[model samples]
Target: MAKLFEPFTIKNITLKNRIVMSPMCMFAVEKEDGIVTPFHVTHYESRAIGGTGLVMVEATAIEPRGRIRPSDLGIWSDDHIEGLKTLTDRIHAHEAHAAIQLGHAGIKAQTNDIPIAPFSEEGTVTAMTPHMIDQMIDQFKVAAIRARKAGFDIIEIHAAHGYLLNQFLSPLTNKRSDAYGGTREHRYQVVKKVIDAVKAVFHGPLFVRISADEYHEAGNTAEDFIYFSQEMKAQGVDLIDVSTGGVVNVPINVFPGYQVAHAEMIKRGADIATGAVGLITEAAHAEEILNNQRADLIFIGRELLRHPYWPKVASEALNVELEAPTPYKRGWN
Candidate 1:
């Protein structure tokens, strides 16, 4: 069997293979009411049917105003649970585990509502007050609980991509003088609180997506993420879905597996499992990473978008027989 087809287990949740469908926003939620549409159902189900081990849903907002795009999916209320349950059921029916990235866009939100952040911005948003900070933590906890109720197998914290959590984590974006700011330990306080809150409500495996390299010299780097990963590990985080350069708007010289090195660093340094993402398209490349233990899982994004059956096709490319959908069961290994 190919290494990519090997099962991976974190906590009690075990994936059928090492290939994970990286959560990419579909922007298919047209109603802007935080409900998952039929588009989302088909979009995610396609990947699961393609035989991915795990299918991570996109960055879903915990609050309406926290949406990155107006059409972005959300989990702010009980009303959103049913649509999410449909998605979970579709994924499970295809024998793939489901995960949803609980996220808040923060100051970067495209919506007209002013976003709250770690630092107050003039004529726009304000630095999060202690009360607001506590509320957001509870929101994350509630979102996690909702995810569990929706039948998701995992919950991912979107602490990456200049989002609310990353804005707090990045020193350049966070300029608060309070306890939620200043020192590195203090900057981590919000994330620590979010993690604790989620763990309190979520019993399944927890994952956090982080930009290991913020690209700027003053921004975060792989080494910094090593520390963050260690802290999350201590807090019972099961995996780090490693991505790079989303703190500030800057050009990134991206290439295949460019972020895999970062994942390897965090994995070895933090002694924790990690999922490598970024331009990792080819099966051989993904297999090599697994073969060398560079990362625990390979998160395929754009390629997965272009080829929903990438995993099934990859099995053929690697000459490892893998099961396909019932109608296409020529290879059922």
Candidate 2:
């Protein structure tokens, strides 16, 4: 079997291949009510048809207020179940395992708002109190229940990109001198609570995405992620989806695979399953990452968005035949 086309299993789920569609926020849902639309369905279904082994839904808000933008998809209530169910069933019909990335926005809650960049703007962020933290945990638990009901095979908690959980994990953003801040263990408490709550409600596998390093002058380092990964594994986290930067302003001058070192560190330091994402476009590059045992999975973001049939093209380029959906045989070029 081709290295990238080989099957691999994580807990109770088995991925037909290693090529996974990285979670990309499409902001396709209609209205501010966070309703899933046909656009959302078609976006993911197309990826499934393109032969991705595991199709992860975009960064879904676990709470309505956690929405990054007005049109982002969400799973905060029971009403979202039907639409998500439709999307999951459609992806599965194409023979791909469906996964959902659930998360809260935290300090970076509304960073995507163009007019008022939270980093530069003041008075927009509502400091999350201890009670609010508990409420956030409950929201994640309920959202996981909804995702499981929606037919998702795996659930990944979005902890990267300086999102809610990431904010708490980063000392730079989390200035709260309380239990949810100060020390590394305390900062991690918020996500740990959310994880415990979700595991109680959902029996399937759980994955956590993390910014191995904030990639800033005053950000968490690779050593920080190694410790976080160790704690995550101890808390029953199945995989660490490693990505970097985003805590502060990004320097566009950084070279490609600059973040891959974070993935390599987490895998080696923690000896757990890790995924290397960011600018991973070529087949040889992806295969080499896996072959080198740097990361167990490779998540393609912008590249997959530019080419929904990337998995198909990658298969052909790698001399591997990906299983195309039956009805699309004529267009399998």
Candidate 3:
């Protein structure tokens, strides 16, 4: 097995370690205008300094209305680039590569505020129109360009978590009868364009975050993901970030490595690199995923949030490192 702390390379970018800081929306941004705040920079900086190899910033909306929360960071405008640049520079200084996850919330848009269609009996989200969908595609392109200016080494498209792209993949949510919905290929058209546009602006590796299974009572299936992953790989996606079950109306019962199955499936089924996320906390568990070749990378979310020094601690626990961070060297006993 390639040890978890060993450097891993994808394309021209070589991560100092296999540990990746998965993007988690903290809703820490102050406004919906997509401006990067000091809080966002500080939040990510902590992780970078903790010794993560790839510090993927949180889910940044590509457009204003496409935002999931009122305070989500965005890369839609030039104004957002400077703050993002500060984040990238800080992470780089700490020997970590920076990545941005660009996405639109789609019909799941504005979960924190505003109104749209197919509202619950209590009234909430509304389905997006064809016009809104088209605008989102363009927004993704513009956001990708902004990310490049901000000095991101990689751009991951958020197509998972039952957001806009996942909604389209679901027969339950996507009721559109046009080219935007129905059938597998037509449902994926919007995201495919988003990927293509982002690739045009980003010169480095590209990643596509995907929900391998919608896990809805009546929802998109693993087969749906297989088809989607295949198309995504064909479109030049560098890796598939596999996660599952974000659209459930009730709490989901899952165990550790529950989502790893999705990653394993996509990696083998599509013959592409996959990043396994969710409940991947322990060093042994992450190592197992790599040893089995189930995933190319292990993305830790809540665990990293709880212990920013997870990589360093894990390296020590695995007995694989010569020393810990200089400041924390004494604490590494």
The parts of candidate 2 lying over 4 Å away from their true place are 111-122
Every candidate's CA RMSD:
1.3, 2.7, 2.5
TM-score of each: 0.98, 0.94, 0.92
lDDT of model 3 at residue 278?
85
Runs off by more than 4 Å, candidate 1 = 330-333
Window of ten residues with lowest summed lDDT in model 2:
112-121
lDDT tens readout by residue for model 2, 97-172: 9999997665655535422111223575466667777878898989999999999999999988878788888887
Q: Candidate 1, clashing residue pairs? A: 120-127
Error of 2 at 117 (Å): 14
Clashing pairs in 2: 105-164
For residues 137-238, write the lDDT of model 1, one tens digit per residue: 999999999999999999999999899999999898989898988877888999999999999989999999998888898886666788899999999999
| Steric clash count of candidate 2 | 1
The positional error of residue 162 in candidate 3, measured at the CA in angstroms, is: 1.6
Cand. 3 TM to true fold:
0.92
lDDT of 3 by residue, 1-333 (tens): 337877788889999888899999888876557787888778898888888999999899876777888788877788988999999999998889999998777656765555442223334555567776677778888888888889999999888787777666667666677887778788788778888887877779999998877656577777778888999889899999998777656576687888998899999998999999988888999998998999999999999989988887787668776345567668774
Alpha-carbon shift of residue 112 in model 1 (angstroms)? 2.1
lDDT of each: 0.91, 0.83, 0.82
